[model samples]
Target: MPEQVKLRDGTDTWVLALEPSDRERLVAGFEELSDESRRQRFLAPVSRLSEAMLDHLIDDVDGVDHVALVLFAEGPPHVYDPVAIARIVRYPDLPDAADLAVTVKDDWHGRGVASALLPVVIRRRPEGVTRILTEVASDNPASLAMLRRLGPTKISNTTPGVWDIEVDLTAHDLPQPIPLAVVPPEELDGKRLHPVLDAPGRHALRTRDLICPWLN
Candidate 1:
């Protein structure tokens, strides 16, 4: 069943598990983000998501190591369009932790699209994952503030322009975590989001950082 939500602005939306068939919708959603939004989300001036990048994003969302939710708004009558997606990719070596990121279409900004997704995402996170990890660009204070609201968080500057954040998922007011169907990575297969490998003291790798897979 799809989860329905009413935004703070009195708009109705539905939240559902993102599936492989939603590739076109996912692509469309990325096209809707502003340059600054892409910068804050991917930590780079990503003008386009190449085919390889899209494959990395959609191919491994197994509801375990990679769990994701898409939020959609009603269009004409029964039609629904994706407005945002929130996802976590579990660390291959560190099963109890997952890297997190949320992307909302630029038009839906300040409308509580994310607020509606976070709790459901939390309640349904992969088993043994008690922590959520992410790196927010230092310049994006909005994301920084949102990270603070998740739970007890440990945050620090891993690089000159990025803030590494880890939020205690168990500390949040959500139901206990459950064991999800595990999907073993054939190898250590995740995109490195931050350009720097020398992020001294960084807790987790950017698991979905294939923003520029070809360059890597």
Candidate 2:
């Protein structure tokens, strides 16, 4: 079942795991992309979705290895229009990482559709997969912001206008709060501590020079 949600513009929508039967929606989605949009998205001249490409996108999906979350236009469940799709497919050699790809119908640009759908797919990615890899065109601020918003990123490849980066998803796994260190007593054995611990400013540090403030 698709999960009900709303875009940043308050437009109602739903998302589901992409299915092989959703081939028509995939075709329509790709068909709607302008040439520039296609280039920005696929990083090459992708005028059409080749049969092999379609097969891979359609058939190679599994919730674990090739996770995809497909967003639909506002409509009933049975009748649907797929407005966007985000996929995270694990690398065969790098099991801990996956290549991230996201596409939105050209008409839906600037509506916060990808912003809403991207993190969900990343969060839904398998446990062992702690890194996400992708390329974003320098001019495509939308896609760049989408990836950066999810986790800490590092540029792993130097492409002229296109950025090949890796996202450290584990950074999102914040550590459990542990008790802070016990504050050091000002006096050790009834004398000021060495350096008085971390003194405030220059004056404080100067006053803290002695291990213990013993009279000369």
Instruction: Give each prediction's root-mean-square deviation over alpha carbons.
Output: 10.1, 20.9
Give stretches of model 1 more than 4 Å off: 75-79, 172-216
What digit string (tens of lDDT, one per residue) describes model 1 on residues 39-142?
A: 77767677776676676677877887888787777656777777777787777767777777777777777888777777777777888988876778878666
Residues 154-189, model 2: lDDT tens digits: 542244566555677878453332211221332112
Span of 10 residues, lowest total lDDT, candidate 1: 207-216
Checking candidate 2 for backbone clashes, the offending pairs are none
Error (Å) of candidate 1 at residue 119 is 0.9
TM-score, per-candidate, Cα-based: 0.77, 0.73
- In candidate 2, stretches whose alpha carbon ends up further than 4 angstroms from where it belongs are 75-80, 173-216
Judge candidate 2 at residue 150 and give its lDDT.
67
**Candidate number with greatest TM-score:** 1
